[model samples]
Target chain A: MILQGADALIECLKQEGVEVVFGYPGGAVLTLYDALYNSQFPHVLTKHEQGAVHAADGYARVTGKVGVCIATSGPGATNLITGIATAYMDSVPLVAITGQVGVSLIGKDSFQEADICGITTPISKHNYLVKRAQDLPRVIKEAFYIARTGRPGPVVIDIAKDVFAATMDYEYPTEVSLRGYKPLFAGDEEVLRVCLEELRQAKKPLLFVGGGATISNMAPEIRKFVNATGIPVISSLMGLGVVPGDSSEHLGMVGMHGTYAANMATVECDLLLGVGVRFDDRVTGSVEHFAANAKILHFDIDPAEINKNVCATIKVVGDLAWSLPLFNKLVKDFAPDIKEQTASWREQTAIWKQDKPMTYKSREGVIMPQQVIAKLNELAEDAIVVTDVGQHQMWTAQFFNFRQARAFVTSGGLGTMGYGLPAAIGAQIGLPDKKVIVFCGDGGIMMNCQELATAADNGFPVKVIVMNNQVLGMVSQWQRLFYGERYSHTSLKGRTDYVKLAEAMGVTGFKAEHPGELEDILKKALATSGPVLVEVALPSDEDVMPMVPPGGCLDKMILGEC
Target chain B: MKYTLAVLVENRPGVLTHISGLISRRAFNIESIAAGHSEEVDTTRITIDVEVDDELELEQVVHQLSKLVDVIKIVNLTRVDHIERELALIKVKASKVNRSDLVDIVEIFRAKIVDVNRETMVVELTGEASKIDALCEVLVDFGIIEIVRTGKIALSRGPIAAKEM
Candidate 1:
């Protein structure tokens, strides 16, 4: 139907099955915002543009769909850069729509004009600057498609003010033709065979699957591959939940802050099969010595990432869904070459796992961080776990048995401190049916603690568990290790009572200092409907274990017992 | 190993700054850096050779180089199969007796005489990094005064170009 550009946009979003959008209004997008005022779709008004984009990111992480965020041009559009970069780095699907300066004022550097397209080119997967109102419907459809497909990432569409106001006929196309955008989603047969052959011939083979495997729904295939070969699996931080955490062969996470056995396997394995992992610097510390002697077979959906990081002897460019199955079939075909005794390998891994087991007996009076996470995992009712960066993030990663991909969302690459509360709000907005839990440390939570108001104001109910160590615990841990027992600038002193803060934000708040109180408060927090916060205070000296010293090799990990 | 690297990069905004920033961030030493337009106008080729510890580090250097947005292509042409070449001009004390011998040395190395005067001769040599070093070493006997050597610029063997994708 022929309609005003703003109304057409609203109709297009409705047609695309969008129920919620995270945004903040400004002058450039006033018409669009006004159109949304009476619309059936619910729009979340984030306090800041950064908050809006992050909320959209959280939504994307939970829903596995293209999250939509809107903002006006100039300062509003520029403010989305950090959020866009974060989403881009983590491969979160986001469609960001910005109201540009009027088409007539474009290139004149109008008061509200900023070339968001040019600015975000490097960070975004793809972006468009719509000069005409007629292009709005197709552009949004394309933006959503590009953002959600392939290696999911942020895509921006900047519509000029005039474009948002002019009359246009809206017809959302069923498909988009992007000349510069085509993602590879099927594996090459010959390469798959070579990888399989290599995997079969190796004495010890390990599969390192990342978030891509989960995004592409290749978990079943990964399980199949593991079952067929009995190969052990390790995951990157973002790659958690790709494999069932409770699996016997799961070697846990691998990287700077990963499990000892996982890092050891990466270093010493004869053949390392990487699926959907980018080999980030945190994952491959001292890249020169990383897998120095191993033959690597890397399979990824993105062509640009093929040789961008780790060297691959056999590179497969395809989606995980297609590549994993092809690999499974190829391994079956090459069963004759398969001969490797990994019993000894498994024994060594088991020995290390037993030597430095992750455990903590709750003290009679003090509520430990480990106990909180363990209890949360137990009573989560299979909730989505979102974490803020710090010691709490590490503890959550270590303790939670995440069974599904996208079940756990954390700042994997950037490790942004204030990511939790806003992200949880977004997650709740996206998955209204599921319980979204924000696990954050005191220091990290305070970074974006202001977002509690946004959550309560929007009525997006999320269970927030603040691990109150009362210091920048991760940094303090580092200082304790590297410095001369000096603690500086890590402690949060005289901060407002968090329970009072929650109350001020109109959400129920609870505090627990003992293990008994911890379980009871968590159960109560889980039972409450709206936004909630449960503070569990642990000792100041608590530390995350199985830690490798800075610049130290994988096998040189400081075992807790040792 | 002290290796020379030549990077053929896309001539675009912020390319050099991006490369330099990465070098600074990674703490990889840049012994020498020279950037200029190549045979193609829109393509800027940078020749940088860093003295580092191991071959694995060299691979990592190349990988990091590839991550830069403006860096269209990166080739570790030093250790791998490639044509390595460097231009060096040496102004040595060409005496009455050893003048002809210096000329012979220059001729032997296929060095060109770009400039010559009564008491000074500027010999320009283009060859592999080792070959240039050897030429410089040979000139030291004749009392080397001034030396300017371009860091090694290299291209892979035969018809293969560095894959930009």
Candidate 2:
């Protein structure tokens, strides 16, 4: 059928099985908006472009699908920059579509014209500027394909305004033949054989999983491998949901604020199997000291990442989907009694966990941030918990026991604030039956507080819990610890009531001021249903403990209040 | 060690930007880079010169560049039997008295005078970078005014193309 470019884009979106697009209408995208209206496709008009993109990111994380968002040219496209970068850092699959100025006006600085393709080139896996109607189908197809392939990331597609009015014989392409874009899915068997041999011989073997494993849906494989090898598993912050929280073998997240067991195990282990991990500076406190004794085995889809940060003795450079299952299969087939080899090592790590468990002493009449998250964790079982970046983000990662894959979604790579509310709304939208809860700091929630209106309007039942500490908790903690207790400009003491703010935004509001009130109020908030906000008051001085000073080794952590 | 990489890529509008942008983004310094259409249809080959600290870092540069969606293939010409050349056009401050001497120096280097004017003459030399540098060193006596150089271009000495390699 012959159709305009915008209509053809709609057809392509349908063919890609896109359920919805989160975006706002603007001048440059008017023709596309008209096409959307004609098609009556499912669309979300977010409060802001940032909100829409983040919502798309959240939806993608929850649904394990390519999240699509749209915006017009210039500022609308620019606003999506932070969200795109956030998704890129986290390796989330997303496709952002933006309408551009007409073809002739492209370089002339016409109204709403911006070099979005160039702006997003670094952040996106790939980007394109489509000037012809005929290119719509292929571009859309390729964008989605690239976004969700090996080592998934965001892709941008900018459409010229004039092309939307141009007509074409629209047929969605069934296959993409990009010569440079094939995703590698296999690793060298010889390398795997050597890695397995090392694992079999090592007395102290540690399995460190990261976001890559989760992205590849390697949770089951990780579980089977850990069970077979008896290698105690540690995780990066992004690897939270990849291992079930209740497992005895799974040590908690390892990083600057990692648990004592995970950190010590990392230091003491002789064979470190870093599966689908980047060995980020945050994870490896000091690169030279990180796994100093261990021969690192790296597994990832991107070959560039193998030696980018950490050197690997055994490089299984392929998709975790292929390599991990193979690892599990080999261990099951050949090393069925591999757990016997690491039994004593596992016991030693368990003693480390016992030495310094992640714990805090409660103060009289005070609502600690940890208490709020713990209460939420207790009450809101089977809910997707999302968090904005801050003390609350770390607290969520540290305290909340995430059992579901892709359940604990946050801006790990970019540490993006203002991510929670919209992402929670997006998750709720994607999985309507699943409960969605968002944890935000007072500073973070205010960054995108306008989204409360978006939530209330859409009536997405995402429980928003703002851990309202009167100051920027993490910043003040850093200043107090590292600097000479000079708080600087971290205080957010301005008079703004979150409960009133929630009510004003047309959502039900609740507040829990004291420790005794937290669990009951949390229960009520969870039951209130339609986009409720529960502001839990917290003291400002409480710091995320067990922090490794910047560039300090994992062993040199500032444990507890000291 | 410095390496010359012949990167074959799809002749797309922003493919060059993708390659060069990525190199810059990764903080990898490119000594010199030149791009042109290759023998293959709709394919462009880029000759890039880069120096790295070790073999691992060199591998990283190659693997990172290869990650770009428009890059079809990358061949390390320095690793294989390759013919490398750099073309430089040097416009020397020429005088009637020194013109014969400058011509003598040019002849010794087997360089050609591509352009000439009353006061200046442009000498074109195609050779290895060291050879071009040597010629410039000799012509320095005539007071070299300005010079333009095509960074470097290379081809492996084999029947197989870079894409095949």
Candidate 3:
């Protein structure tokens, strides 16, 4: 069909099975917004461009689809920068469409002009500047394909204003054929055989899963492998939901603030089978001491990450979705009695789990952040939980019990604040039938609190639980331990009523200042038909426990309050 | 130790900035770099020379460069027997009396005098990096006015294509 670039973009989106877009319109994108008005595709107008991009990111994480977002040029494009980087770091599939000035005005510094393609080069999987209306269809096709392909990441397609108005005969490309871009899916048979032999012979073998496993949709395969071998599983923060929380063989999250048993198991294991995980600094406290006694078996789709941080004794570079099942098959065929081989190791790990459990002191009259997360977990077991970075994020990772794949979504690599509320909006929009909750800290909530209006306006029914500690909890903890406890600028001293703020944004609001009132307030907030916010006041000085200090080994963790 | 890496990347604008930005952001110094279109249809090959403390730093540089989306492949030329060359243009101060001597020096190095004037003479030399440095050292005595040198470009001495690997 012959159509203008803006109409063609909408056509391409429909062809790619995109049902909704999160965006904010501006002068540069006025024509596209006009096209959207007459089209059936729903575009949710977000309060901020950053919130739109983050909502897209959240949608992609939950639905496993390439989430789409649109914005104007210059500031609008720049506002999406943080969210784009967040998506890039976490390997989420997102396609950001930005409106640019006309081609003649691009480099001339015209009004509202910026070099977005250049700015996003390092952060995006790939980017394009559309100079012709004819190229829009092909670019859109390639953008979606690249965003959703191997090692999924964000891609940017900046369309010029004139191109949006120009006419073109559009035909969406059926397939993408880039000569230099091919992702490997199958693992080498020889490498799998070697890994199987190591698993069969090792006295103590542990399965370490990461976000890569979850991204590749290999949770079922991982669970099958773990069950067949009876190997204990430890997860990175992003890998939390790959193994059900109820599984006896699964250890809690392992990292800087990981559980005691998880960290100990990492140190004592003889063989570490890492799947779909880059050894981030948080996970491997000190590289020299991380898995020192283990022969590492690393499996990932990105070859650049194989030996980037930690070296693998036997590296298998392939998609986890394919390589994991192959490993399962090889184990079933070769090492049928793998459970007996690692029986003693499991017994030792059980002792570690029992000796040092995750514990926090219960103050008589004060509410605890851990208790709030625990209560939410109990009441909303099936809700998709999202969190912003900080003390509450770590607390959620520690206290909440995630039961299904893609049930927990948070900014892992970038650790960006203001991520929870918008991401919760995205999750709620993606899975409307499922409950969606955002566990945010006071510091993070204040960063993008404007998103509350976006949720209430759309009636998405997202529940926000704000752990309102009066200080920057994580940074305060670091200062108390490392610095002279000067507490420079970490204490947030102000009186901003969170419940009143929520009500002002047209959302129902509740507050709980005492431990006894939290449960009732939380239940009331969750039962609301529309968006709601529950602000629970927490102690100002509580620190996340089992923290591995900077440059310290996992074994040198601080177990309690310093 | 100094290492040379040949990085093949998609031919696109701002790709060079992406590569250089990554190196600079990591605080790694690039001694010299040269880039041009490769034999591939839409690929450009860039040769970068870096001086690092050890092999570990070199490995990290290679790994980080490979992380860029435009970067298709990268190979360290130090691991194989390779041929490297650099081109340089030196403009030297010249007088009537010293003109013959300057010509003699150029002849000895098999260098060509690309331009000449009453006050200055420009000599162009193309050879291995060491040869270019040697020529520069000899011409310095004649009060060299200015010099421009292309960074080192190298290829392995074999039939195998690095991109195919």
Candidate 4:
């Protein structure tokens, strides 16, 4: 059938089962927007292009679908850069569509004409600039395919203004054939056998999981493997929710601010099985000292990640979905005495957990950030929680007891600020029945505070909790500890009444300053029907504990105030 | 250590920029790069020479380059038996008293005089990078005025294509 390029784009999106798109219209995208005017497809107009992309990111992270966003050229495309990078770093599937000036004006530096494909090349998994209308359908198909395939990341497609009005014979390809792009799904039998042999021989075996477990939807398989092998599991920040936080086999998150038991287990384990983890710097404090005694076995889908940071004793390059179940079967069939082999190691880790439980000082007037997170966790036990980067992010990771995969979403790799509010909006929109909450710091909340309007306009009942500390908590802590308290530009001055700001955006707001009034205010805000913001004033000097100093060994952690 | 890598990539706009941007972003300096169309219809082969201090640096560069979607395959030619060639054009200061001397040096190197003038003569030579460097050193006696050279381009001395690797 003959169709305009804009119509073909809409048809292709519908074919891909895309129900919603987050975007903001501009001059360059006028033709596309006009096509979307009376269409049944839902297009959410976010306040900013950044919010749109982040919203799409949140949607993708939760739904396991390719989140879609659109914006005009130039600044509109540039604004999506950080959000795209955030998705890229975290391996979220996203497709960003941008409108360009006419083909003739592209290199002329015409108004609103930016080389978006060039600008986003380094960040996106792949990008395209469609010069002919006939290529639009194929480009769209390729973009979605690339975005959602193995080791998923964002892909950008820029369309010229003239192409939107041009006509084409629409045909969306069902399969893509790229010589350079093939993902390995099955593990080598020899490699798996070698890994299983190592597992049987080792006494102190530890299972380390990361975001790939969740991305590949292998949480159930991992849980089964841990149960069958009786191996203790430690997770990276992005690996939370794969194994229930309360499970006996699960050690808390392992990293710079990880739990005492988790860090110690990493240092002392003799055989470490890393599934879907990159061994990022934060998780491995000092690569030389990280699991020095362990014979590491790594299973990951991306071959590039293999031996990039830490060398693997037995490397299996394949999808976790295939590898985890196979490993579980192998262990079940063999290694009958695996439970007996690791009994003493488990007993030792239990002692560590008991001796060094996470704690903080309790005071009368000042509300502790940890306590607030704990209270929120109690109230919203099954809610989808998103966080911005800061001390608050760490506190949430420390306190939130996630029970399901994809329950906790944050900017893990990029650690972008201003991620919480928009991401929460996306989650709430995508999963309307599930409760959504944003835990953001004072510094992060102010970065994209305008997203409150997006929530109110959509009538999304997302709860926003601001841990107002009046300072950049993480940087200030670093300065105080490393730079002799020479705090430069860390302290934030002036104040904006968050409750009034929430009210101004047509949402309910509540404030709690004292520990005594915190619970009541939180309950009230959580019970509100529409979007609500709860600003809890916290002590500015609070710090995230159990921090491994940068480049220091995992064994040398600063437990708390000296 | 100096390493030469032959990389096969999809022929598309902005791919070169992507490759160069990644190299610069990782702080890996490219000593020389030569790229052109390949036998395949929609593929281009780029030969890059990079200097690294250790094996880890080389491994990292390979890993990062492989992550790029456009990059199809990469092969390190340094470890294999490969034939390498570089082309050079040298314009030496020539006069009646020394023009014969320059001709003798050019004949010894089996080079052709592409252009000649009253004061300068342009000699074109193709050989291994080392040979080109050697000839340039000898021609300096005639007061070499200008020189242009292509970066090293290498091919494995076998039927196996770098892409097959």
DockQ of each: 0.06, 0.83, 0.45, 0.62
How high is the DockQ of candidate 2? 0.83
**Which of candidates 2 and 3 is the stronger one according to TM-score?**
2
Candidate 3, superposed: residue stretches over 4 Å from native? A333-336, B26-29, B50-69, B72-81, B156-165
Clashes by residue pair, model 3: none
- Model 4, A85-116: lDDT tens per residue? 99999999999999999998889989988889
Single out the weakest 10-residue window by summed lDDT for candidate 2 chain B.
B15-24
Question: Every model's Cα RMSD, please?
Answer: 7.2, 1.2, 1.9, 1.6
Clashing pairs in 1: none
TM-score of chain B of 2: 0.97
Ranking by DockQ: 2, 4, 3, 1
lDDT of 2 by residue, A1-562 (tens): 9999999999999999999999988988999999999999999989999999999999999888999999999999999999999999999999999999999999998988889988988888999999999999999999999999988999999999989999999888889999998999987977888887898889898999999988999898888787777778899988987888768888888989888889989999999999888999999989999999999999999999998888998899999988887777777865555687678998998888877888887899999888888877888768999999989999898889988789988999999999988898889899999899999999999989999999999898889999999899888999999899999999998889899999999989999998887888888888886989999888988989779887899888888842
- For model 1 the TM-score comes to 0.78
DockQ winner among the candidates? Answer: 2
Q: Which stretches of candidate 1 lie over 4 Å from their true place?
A: A104-115, A333-340, A360-364, B1-165
True contacts kept of 1: 0.00
Backbone clash total for model 2 is 0
Error of 4 at A559 (Å): 0.4
Q: What local lDDT does model 3 show for residue A416?
A: 93
Q: Which ten residues in a row have the lowest lDDT in candidate 1 chain A?
A: A333-342
TM-score ranking from best candidate downward: 2, 4, 3, 1
lDDT tens string, model 1, A450-545? Answer: 788898887888999988888889999988988976998887765668898888988789998776677778889998999998877788878877
